[model samples]
Target: MRFVIKVGTSLIAPGGRIDTVLMRALVDQLDLERHEYLIVSSGAIASGMSKLAFSAKPKSVRLMQACAAVGQSLLMYTYEQLFFGKKVVAQLLLSSDDFTSALRYENLQHALHELLKLGVVPIVNENDSVSVRELVGAFGDNDELSALLATAVKADWLVLLTNVDGFYDSAGRGQKLVRTVRRLTPKMEALCGEKSELGTGGMRSKLRAAMMASENGVQVAIANGTAPQAIRNAIERKIGTYFPATKPAPKKRAKAAD
Candidate 1:
């Protein structure tokens, strides 16, 4: 099965630096040789903050861009070192226009197919170094980008990994995880809120992306990236909030005469 795994910055760089422990754990948990796997990762800016000596997320777009430029390589390097002998990993820096442009989109599609065929895993991230809009947070966050990529690649599933365990609802006195959401309701969508200190996306963006993917025939799962067996659990429909695909009715076989 083809799956797009979007890793949030919160999980990758919770405070500022690349959490090697978490990264190692995630890498060790992943065993997707037989499946077509794509990772749309966030955390360049967060990772850059440590390298650039910034204590907090920068306010300037130029500074943010600089951070992304500095952090992107570090992000990939970590992935490279972890997946060294286990699997080959390739980096893909993308812009919103890449998908808007028919040729670029198709070329990317071809390149990804080739990489997968060659037993390589493509690790994708927004081209924050040069993408003006991306730096300024114009286009939707990586959550939305993952949905777009999943659609472009016609992936069977899109699993969004975040700090939150799953979609939560305010129950009686506390918040409770909503395990299965057949359809995202208006109330549920309203629950999405502010972003973390290090990243732009939040629960709302993920829900929107999930709804979009589900509408276009791609199942979606939102789970805690740090949790044990997160990816496996999401794929197995054992944990997280699952959104199954909604497709056109299948043609029915005609009834035979008795």
Candidate 2:
């Protein structure tokens, strides 16, 4: 199965520092020979903050971009080290235009498919160092990006790995995990809480992304990134809030003759 796994900043760099041990554990779970995996990770800024000794995420756009510039390298380097001798990994820094523009989108699809064909794991993130949209509250902290990538790549599963186990039902006396959500509703939106301090997206943004991917025929699972074998469990529907695809995936049409 092809999976677009999104790991949030909170899990990647809790306390504003990259957790190499935790990251190694996550990497250890990858079964590259059995399935294809693409990672959409968010942590360049946080990793930068750590390297620069910034206590918190900077409000200044330029400063945040600078942080991304510094951290993106560190982030990819770490991934490269972890995946060494296991699988070749490629870094893809993307912007909204990559998806919005027709030519760019087609080119991106071709590139991604080609990389996958070579058995390379693509590590994607927003081009935060240059993209104002991404740095300034766009892409919902890479949630939307993952969904869009999943749709474009025709991924069978889009697993959103976060701190939470799954979406919850907070209306009752205590919060109850909602195992399956076939369709999104107004109530789900109402249940959303605030965004994370370290990360831009919260449950609200995740739900929105989930709705988008599910509608595009990509099954989505919002599961806890910190959980043991989280990726495996999420794909198997053993944990997290599963959103089954609602629409059929559009068949890829052959290019017309010039």
Model 1, residue 35: displacement in angstroms?
Answer: 1.6
Against the hidden true structure, what lDDT does model 2 obtain?
A: 0.90
Judge candidate 2 at residue 222 and give its lDDT.
Answer: 95
lDDT over C-alpha atoms for residue 104 of model 1: 96
Give me the displacement of residue 22 in model 2, in angstroms. Answer: 1.4
Tally clashing residue pairs in candidate 1: 0
For residues 1-258, could you state the per-residue lDDT of candidate 2 as single tens digits?
Answer: 788989999899998899998889888988888888999999999999999989988999999999999999999999999999999999999999999999999999998888887889999999999999988776787999999999998988899999989899885578899998887789888998888887888998899999899999999999998989998888875599999999987664332312
Off by over 4 Å in 1: 248-258
> What TM-score does candidate 1 reach?
0.91
Question: Which tens-of-lDDT digit does each residue in 175-202 have in candidate 1?
Answer: 8888877777889877766778899878
Winning model by TM-score = 2
Q: What does the lDDT read for residue 191 in candidate 2? A: 94
